[model samples]
Target: MMITNNPPVLNDTAILNIARDVLDIESTALSELKAQLDENFVHAVRTILSCKGRLVVSGMGKSGHIARKIAATFASTGTPSFFVHPGEASHGDLGMITEDDVMLALSNSGKSDELMAILPFLKRYGTRLIAMTGDSTSPMAKLADVHLLVKVNKEACPMNLAPTASTTAALALGDALAVALLKLHGFNEEDFARSHPGGALGKRLLTYVRDVMRTGDEIPSVVLGSSLTTALLEISRKRMGMTAVVDETQKVLGILTDGDVRRLFEKDVDVRTLVIDDAMHRAPHTISPDALAVSAVQLLDTHHINQVLVTDEQGVLLGALNVHDLFAAKVM
Candidate 1:
């Protein structure tokens, strides 16, 4: 490849037009690809579901990148799949494929020499092969147990040499397969969360109230019989904007919040004459420490409150959480 030190003059209008044309071409390619789905697709899904071992995806060149992404999608969605380079597999990585496993090979032209070299070995090994390609009559397609035709009308590249629309169509088809398998396998958000525990979705779905709540002395709380002034002091010291009012046995009796104090002042009541029992809300929204953090967030949203108490089955305050706590946990 030769680097051009002197490039052509910039044409902003032409660049934007070319961008639109590229999208239009890829969009049409996907539409045509959708119309081509058939029973072979069904057979492919069933084949994967019946697979007792991992799915091994293999490809060459640009299709290899698409294969890697498809493999990742399948793995994250509970299919237990991974990508293996056909070139590498021909050397010794083919050992990763077992008789119980299924192999999905990607090759747009269906004639990549590297992928072609491994098909015979997979056949003798009894590993099922599913080929995604553009030509049904190609060797890779003919050798596959299930052939998924991803043939596009034309490449998005004006020269029709670079992979553009074909790759997009292949990627979309991979998503379709992963989603279909996900539905059939009964994989849910929690399952996805387990596979992606470091991601935002995992944090939202997996984190519990106990995981993010402030406990022990760190929690802002006051006992029953405490004066309104005492409760306010606890709230200010803990900086949670609220204090749990608990009985002698630590059972929740009520809750006192800054917003409640504001309401009292709004009515022009004498603050000095107020007691904790008189000022506190008799019933406060509470959640279990074991509940999902997202549930706590929703509880606060539903009640239009910024803070919530975490309680045990007997209504004993175990911990506390505010909007900031949820934000820190990234559950919001």
Candidate 2:
């Protein structure tokens, strides 16, 4: 009988050790990248900032994946940018680029034929070229307006043929560039939130008190000197768990809550005999119509109350809202 050769099987310890080694190698490569930040990086950032048009990122293979992520980071951080495949650039996609635009190219070997083919077209169109590569002496790097060094000492693969450490270094460098530009442009959290309005952070940042508060006839309120019975009826009719006590001019005087009613009952006093001004809590927490809805939610939580009055600068009641309103608006 003839027996076939079998592949070697790795034990648990060997598998774990290989994984640890890969992580260690990638970590060291990142450390090296931090040290490689120099004047060339500054020049690249300056070129991108000075460009009048959008930034166009292009790469091949693994570099293409990293390039797409970099483009997204830049766009979300207030920089206008998009990615183009090098292969497609040679086709009709090159028309997407213009003379005013800047091109950011990624190539682990610094010698991707697809990218090299479009280099001349970019140059002829007067588009600035920023190359991220491992080989500073390669033709692509030498031809670039600015070269960002992303070289790695070794690959994580045992054969040293895969683009592992080099790709990580390139991705880190791209992130660095994006963050630097973000700061340079004074991009703040609000700007980022605006770009991502569908996200939770965006909702919290962009939602204002006026956007969620119950306005017009929806607001539950009683005029000053109104009987506690009248106030209670208004609260029950509005179903907001409370009612605002306002003056003749609609200026907020105080707020009466369910807790206040409970306390009043505990006192064994006839609530019908008291006026709303006597039972309502003075100096109640109030929010401005221009304030963020998140602020209203925080006020409700901090004061341990279920409702708050929305007022204008003149202290006039503009609207009212409860914890439920905030929940319905997804502000909580």
Candidate 3:
């Protein structure tokens, strides 16, 4: 018998090389997809744009996972969409499909049994079909009113059978479709923020101090001539680490923080008789209530101040912000 020799072991470098090969293959597949964009892609987008009802996405296995993610991307980016497993659709989920809805199906081989089983039912419902497949002549593509060809050169898997490059190509195609529609609809960052209110981008873009900051009775404010004792009470009541020293017109003059109070204590200053101006930091950094929370974070970092007083362009005191407020808003 002839003995065959192969690499003896897998080391970290070998593993990393394998990873790089997979990434390179997938990257090439996606880049190839960009050149294939043509009138067919445009028709697909137009069909989806004209859709009055929800978009129903379906696939099997790895394609199913990508379909679910694509559905989520569509839903969050101004297009109303959801994913329905192809197998589930055959069982009972088909009831979710309606005449007004558009169906999007994904199949690497273009002939998944589960997906094929539902084609008749979808056609019967008069639902338009958009197919994403590797072969345009495949059954699913033939049945589709619009077929998006995602033919990839090869799989990134060493076995050349596993779904890797194909899936990446499909994912990139889905993103391209969603973003194209988003731009056509003129979706802006504010609209995106509305869709993802819990995320950091949303907080950085949409959050304003007036939406998260203490104001009116909750805001710690003391007159310039007020005694340090009164300022301390204001600070304690608000618990915002600082109090704004303002003139009688409610225009901010300075700020008195816990650090200033500690300094006063070290100096054995008389709180009852000393005015707020005697202990406050003059020319304190401030912002407008309309300023984004991210901007406030920048101010805090630049001046090394934990709190920032919000004022109008006329310099009238409006509200305040602290590092805690930025934390709570997720702007930090």
Candidate 4:
């Protein structure tokens, strides 16, 4: 007989209980942190708001990881900030700090050796300090112009030694700070899109019809008196699946699509004898070139049409775009 290679299975209820216990502990820590917020929290925000220079956040070990994310949040949401590891700042990185800058130091114990080593130098240099720590009486807290206490009742770790719940609370508080500052500074979606121009959201919010519409010779269009066959040829040549029918002033009169051609064929109509007037869709859907690309998508979806004409305020045809254009721009 050979020993079985099957792995031991955990009790489902026990495994779920452990996971839920961790979440409950962390959630409780956040609620307590909310209750603990007082004038100190206000002073921290005020100090950063009045600052003429950047916010330089520093921490050590696990707390340092949280501080880096906090710094990134601040930077992206209108507050100029970056992380400096306390260990590195104790060495030559200390020169990066300036009296005009505000230093935000994170240390759960408030007694990190590297951080403590730089506090006196920072004090002497006259850089305003904001400290986030568990101990209000610790040297880091005592030296800070404003102390935002992040004292959690306990860690989520079963051993109660890891920086689990405390780190979660710190991260949440940092997010609260960033969000408050951006709102106070009147940051909007356009501002956020500018900050994230390379992402899909940027494509949706920043792209305009003028930026992607086909103009000049690329526009598939036919004159008002052109034959249906001429319109079809123009559509095929431009590869847009539709052609705009325009008058003498280049004002759009109607649109003739491949779908219309197919329907006309199904009705046994004499296509060779027809003009654009007989085949074109009157007053076809149109959009403004200045409108956002996403608005064109909404028009297409609302009308159940794949192509839309771009027009100026006076109803003169400017250009055109289709669903494929928005897709290429990642606006769809």
RMSD of each: 2.1, 3.4, 4.3, 3.9
The candidate, 2 or 3, that scores higher on lDDT is 2
Per-residue lDDT tens digits for candidate 1, residues 50-98, read: 9999999988999999999999999999999999999999899988899
Q: Positional deviation of 144 in candidate 1, in angstroms?
A: 0.9
User: Cα lDDT for residue 246, model 4?
Assistant: 92
The per-residue C-alpha lDDT of model 1 at residue 285 equals 94
Off by over 4 Å in 2: 1-22
Clash pairs, model 3 backbone:
none
The 10 consecutive residues of candidate 4 with the worst lDDT sum are 1-10
- Collision count for each candidate, in order: 0, 0, 0, 0
Clashing residue pairs, backbone N/CA/C < 3 A, model 4: none
lDDT: which candidate is best? 1
Model 1 TM-score is 0.92
* Order of quality (TM-score): 1, 4, 2, 3
lDDT of 3 by residue, 15-92 (tens): 999899989998899888888878989999999999989899999999999999999999999999999999888889
| Sequence-dependent TM-score of model 2 | 0.89
* Per-residue C-alpha lDDT of model 2 across residues 1-332, encoded as one tens digit per residue: 66588857999999999999999999999999999889999999999999899999999999999999999999999899999999998999999999999999999889999999998889988999999999999888998999998999999998999889888889999999999999999999889989999988899889999999999999999998999999989988999988999899999899998778889999998998999988988897899999999989888888888888999988999999888888888879
Q: Tell me how candidate 3 scores on lDDT.
A: 0.91
